[model samples]
Target: MFGRSKPLELNVLVLRDADVIATALRTALAAAAPEERPGLERAAALVEQAAAVPDAALRARWVHERLTAAGHEGPVDSVRAVKTLRESVPGLGLLSAVQLTKDAAAHRP
Candidate 1:
């Protein structure tokens, strides 16, 4: 007898690795419209190297510019920051969840 295939499920855990997240984000960013892609690509590449905590924060702060350059910063431009983060992460913890990255960095696990 033929066996049934299992349904696919995507986990929604918040990732914390810049490299790993950037790889996944690059794919999502490619889904944007043609005109609004270049900036996203730039952000993706830059984001890929945001291994440093400060770089990650800087990227998040200027995420709008990066997306705008890509040609997709629209009415809800703020979303760009959220989207950028969704794609690339620096690490997760009470510190990051509450913007205490510097403190967390100072105190390594």
Candidate 2:
């Protein structure tokens, strides 16, 4: 019989189309000068295929993981924008985040 295990409690955030992000990261890594792309390709695939987690904390964690794979693990102050929006308008920040992404995509060069 297998031993019992403690359930991991995670605040899962539903990130829509995270695989796309992962895919982009992979492409960027492949094109980059360096060749030690450890988790970049997998990260890209995750971003491109992972389902929306339905939790802010989880979403943030996913972002953090991907960002880490992309060689970023410092100064997440800018990434922690949800607290500001939540403080001002509760859960409205989620919509704000989505809208911002939409706007950015629409205006992408």
User: Taking the tens digit of each residue's C-alpha lDDT, what string does model 2 give over 1-109?
Assistant: 5999655433223636565666668678967665546566656556544454434445445444443455544443344433432344344445554443333333322
lDDT of each: 0.48, 0.48
Question: Roughly what TM-score does model 2 have, to 2 decimal places?
Answer: 0.26
Each prediction's total of clashing residue pairs, residues at least 3 apart in sequence or on different chains, is 1, 19
| TM-score of model number 1 | 0.29
Predict model 1's lDDT versus the native: 0.48
- Kindly state the number of residue pairs that clash in model 2: 19
